[model samples]
Target: MARIKVRARAVDMLGRQQIAGIPTAVHELFKNAHDAYADNVRVDYFRADELFILRDDGIGMTLEDFEGRWLTLGTESKVGANDPGKRVWTGPRKATVRAITGEKGIGRLAIAAIGPQVLALTRSIRPEGLGSLVVSLIQWGLFEVPGLDLEAIEVPVVELQGDALPDLEVVTGLADRIRANISHLGDQIPADMRQRLLSELDMADFDPEAIYSQIDGPKLAGDNFGTHFFIRPTNPVLADDIEQSDDAGSEATPLEKMLLGFGNTMMPQSGEPPISAQFWDHREDGISRDLIGGAAFFTPAEFDSADHHIEGEFDEFGQFTGSVSVYGQPARQHTIVWPDSSGRPTECGPFRLRFAYLQGLLKDSRVPPDEWARLSGKLNKIGGLYVYRDNIRILPYGNSDFDFVGIERRRTKSAQDWFFSYRRIFGAVELTHARNSNLVEKAGREGFRANRAYREMTSMLENFFERLAIDFFRPTSQFGSEFNSMKAEINQEAKLLAKRATKTKERQGEFKTELDTFFTSIEKGHPTREAERIRAMTEERLSAVATIKSPEAAADALLNAEADARRAVAALEKSITVIKC
Candidate 1:
């Protein structure tokens, strides 16, 4: 029997309603551990490799918790609650206990997602006398008996097996200790599977002196707080095979580089927290810095049945971002905040669309419903196949990490895919409804409101990233430098852009005037002024102007056509004059 050690029975997934892999089921457990005050957590795999364990030193389980709550499936996590988003795990008198982040009982299913069977063993470490509580695996597996109804509707679950897996008590060895304590298990992870657990426990402890000695000759004290996820796995049945970094010569991991770049960026104040960055560009000129926020899942997919929202005011720094997801289509699925036996969530809405696309829009002008509908129409057809759409035409953006958006394959893998899965996924479309809505009378009708909204969002995102970058890169300075005026540079560029926009508007107006004259000037013009060929006329005029990138040039082409029409009229006038003579 392959023996792997893991903290088990931390919670029961059967108690909650889910049918999936262990990772999906245990999402809640890890969430609680992270949210809890606990700094460390351990996930252990035992004898069968499938026997899972999750242990956290935050706080142990209590009698009421074990019997009534922890074992209860689908508990009401937030009711009349402040921050109904989460639960509060405060030790009596706040005696330095770990904070907990779990809310939904469904998190127990995350374990099921990770593997087939789990042996739960949890205890609370709080005020002196909150005696350790013991709950059995069988008890958890049977927490929800068949045919029980929740307040919402009939519980869809058909059967709840309390004794879902074999029960065993294991003690001793590297795997066992790690199964017990969450902290030590982190470093012990190996790059690829096939190694024994106890064989590498010693490698987990910090090698501070060795690490510090290599940092620019000697390490600075401040950067000591960081977590490292080593890429190594030994023992196939007991461990997982993971991709390893062969760059032993480098002192830092690639993930660390991505993070450090954010910290040392200019205008760092803007890159903190919800503001953490995705990328930074600090040109060696040491004068300019630009940082972009974390890459949010920009889901452009929408369906006719899909109803999603984009709402959030830009913070003080002017960064606006979020998602647009759609699930009403035949293919897409909705995310379930609360699990149901059907494995599909009815409450969490069917579709979402996220984008910084709105960032540019936020700065543009308020977008009208018509324009949004137009974009949604073109975009919804993309499904999992495409990402970017420009000017109502589907644009093939690069593929997403999760392979969800496939350019070549175009297949929807599953409801839960790692490449596209987000712990917190939200998309925003700037609900820009028309500002200066009446300006359409002067500017022309078809695109005024829509154009303004587009310009606004585009402008906001550009400056937003610029500001964030400046803040992030502010810390790293030359030995001597003088205060520079970046805003002045920005102002100058803005003026040029405005001038160009005005010219674009003028050219569009003139293009309409020229096109009408062009067809009239043709001797072969339809003898009748019929309305039937309006569409064809438009096609011909547009085709003529297609090669012209400059709006001004297009307008000139139309004007030339008008000039010909006048000449035709003049020739007829000249003929009558000669006849009278």
Candidate 2:
């Protein structure tokens, strides 16, 4: 029988295919750290030295574990075979409580994907006053040899003895270099820490330098066991791939630097405003410039509870549980135009949506105009619909480029009615490892396969957003209808006033003609009292006609003029009021 063999070229191909980009490869390392149950993971990119370091205080692996499990592909540590062909839970707790994220045992390959060479230095205590450490060097360039079998390649591993090991001295210098590279971590590094390294540093008893003198100094002190992965990419350009702002003149806050560097979803042109303690809630105040138009927006309180917090759970087919909190002023009305199979117009999702009015505004913000735009950019990068399995974000699921629920595509189809955009939402879906095992991720770390459970979950979310759109736009639609009705009524009354003014002018015109005829008849005659009185009444009537034509003139003006004309006629009946012709 012939045995199947994997070529060295296949390993290189898998690395390229699995790790999408530099950012994705970095995210994979974060998952590995989380799986190791590390409370804090430190990632440092030393551009000056073209080095990338990821250090975590997790349970470091021994030489046996490294060769047997870590090096083996498709290791079954996370899940085990139930009988023969099927796999079941293996209780993924090594030395700590954590939901294991590294199931396929290929997370280590991500380091190779980022660079050609990698150094993994891991240390773990075995017994009282005894510990073990190993330094493994993986040079990927050797694997590139054509037609080389993967089984033939061997990574160089060196085991270190107690304090005497020379590797300890090199590690000490490397630790110092890492510390020197970073000026200050600010809130990221605890301020009260005695030693420079927050968790690893112990200056209480041993001299800070003594830790470097012996392997037991800081490296082996108090469960500080971990792996420090150092990789220096062959390409010099890869070192500076992660750009930094070069404005030496202006001091940038930690938050600003993060937004500028990682805000992938930010609009290209809307320049982020300068970070200040004052303009935190600028979104509300800015949009409120037009009060009437802005009133179209609303808060979750209008539709749900006053708390503005929403929570739900699902254990039907797969276990899903999460909560959402909404904040900010409110957003403009977004209508749902997408027609559902049920013949009803769909909105956003079957999952509850708690929209932050100003894109990603949270509750804690009050006076200081929160950088709403920056916050939006940050949310856009993280994803509006965040999906987390075992509290770890699944790749390509909630990422900016990945539209898991087809929100972007639907929005593009008809943006007017289907106005839901990933940028405008800050949402999260939490799934446990045991309950959501059915949401299996692809080997490439792209995302969960489109299985039945995954499809149902996405469909439910889509329906939720759709329903929200319908409910949200209902009141605004009614308000618009009422406004149009009132406008029509006002217009009708204005038209009636114009018609009455027109009729008054016509009567005045007829009276003017009669007066002119009377005057013409008396042109060649002598004085006549009755004729003079008629002329006087006609002049008074003409004055009323002018007032009638001037619609804006007081309504009383027409009435007063008519009364005077009648009196003049009565006077003519009695005797003469003006000289007759």
Candidate 3:
């Protein structure tokens, strides 16, 4: 019998290289928490220990679940939730939220991408309260053993009461003895190293008696069960030490970068619970940062605007159903910004789009002209069309780089018609699982796949923006006072461009007529092939100019064909003068 073997490095490749980044890997874990029906998920970065502790107040997995489902790759537990025919819900969470954010089972392997050592402790909630907590220590290195099949590797699992800490007694005892002995050998060690060693003492911070006394520690959280993922990073480095250099060789890890970028945004502020505390609600604050000071509301009707809205309702399984509101003043014209013959037929359904014209405009543009640089920085840091699935965000979707809906791409193609790009427009398309089941996420957790449903979703969104730009964002007499200065500036710029084009056209026309006349006179006098070819070419150039449909096309013709016509006229005049002499 032939044996097929896979190396452990493959797991690492699948986890790290396959996913976008560490931040995305963490986001996948967050999705897993969401799928697990966790109302509150806490992500803690232990700066000292070089560890990430992601705990959630959700229905945790049982021993069987840990081994059979979690350990097993490509499990179908989450896939069941994708089916609209059946509703997937956990114990008490059923009353609140029934949808799952995860489907592909490979998300669990994201832990391997982030770290090699995973100490996953979870407790399933019983009807009474806390249940038996299961601890699974996964050393990813074991999978990398030579000549070993992935299936052969077994991660050990230990079950304990909700209050029981993993290796608490032994670790605490050792920590205390080590702490006591540290003072004796302190003179031999450097002061900084000694302090570092003292700070690095593990399991000594927690009070053993206090932890043991509680029948249900923070481990069993929320209304039901909870899960804790204690991961020691493979590339462990002190957070502070990472900032010592700015070179590529000394750059921070993805997790470190994410922490530096969004830590302040996601971290709980004043009067909030600590990382160890349970069920801290950061949704409001989080939304504010996530949206970059943009509004987080459902309908534009709430704003009491007379703006127009496009509503879509689909009865098909997993179709989009929601209203897209154009926030700016609706104009009479509805222009299509699509490239010629490249526009796709788009149907609307399954999602909500809100074109927030001035949502973050005030916040971003409030600064003085001199402070425009600061404002630009802020906008770059915190602007984009956000995609919210249900209420939560999908990682890297509406980020600075992930212009998934191709707003900038469209803007580049149709700059005149595009009101604002992904950077300037504070817009969002919200979707619910019940309504948007067909919009499935890619297994690699990048973003939604470009399926027919997603393509339709994107088309509908593009149309919404198009409507806003052509119909609403356009200058109007109704809001003349508001747009008067902008209109004046635009008019002045346009007139200058038009004047330049007119001068160029007159020059080209004069030259073209002269060139054509010269060629025609030559042909009539002594018909030559060169004269016919020159006349033909000149006529072709004139035809090109006449056929110019848009301002862009006209400018292009003036720049190229008009310049060539002038040169031809100059050369023809010189030849005629020479012949006369």
Full-model lDDT for every candidate: 0.31, 0.49, 0.53
Candidate 3 lDDT, 15-39, residue by residue in tens? 6557766666766776677666665
Q: Itemize residue pairs with steric clashes in candidate 3.
A: 320-349, 320-350, 321-350, 331-471
Weakest ten-residue segment in model 3 by summed lDDT: 266-275
Cα lDDT for residue 224, model 2? 53
Q: Name the regions of candidate 2 deviating beyond 4 angstroms.
A: 81-96, 126-130, 163-223, 234-241, 244-311, 314-374, 377-383, 475-581
Clashes of each: 105, 24, 4
Error of 2 at 357 (Å): 4.7
> What is the per-residue lDDT of model 1 for residues 1-581, given as tens digits with 9 covering 90 to 100?
99743222333324333423222233345445433433434333322212233445445455455555654655664322224234455544353322222344555443433432223434444545434323332212222222222221111111112212112222122234443432333333342311332333332332323432422211113211111111112123222211114644222222221122211111112222111222222233433222222222122232222232222334322333332222111222212121112343221112212332211121221233455554433232212212111111011121122222221221134321121211111222212111112212111111223354334433443343233223221333221011112223334556666788888878876665555555454445443232224445555666787788899999987776556555655654443331110
Candidate with top TM-score is: 3
lDDT of 1: 0.31
Q: What shift in Å separates residue 215 of candidate 3 from its native position after superposition?
A: 18
Residue 184 lDDT (model 1): 33
lDDT (C-alpha) at residue 261 in model 3: 23
The estimated TM-scores of all candidates read 0.29, 0.55, 0.58
Query: Per-residue lDDT of 481-516 in model 2, one digit per residue for the tens?
Result: 332343345456556656887887887776676567
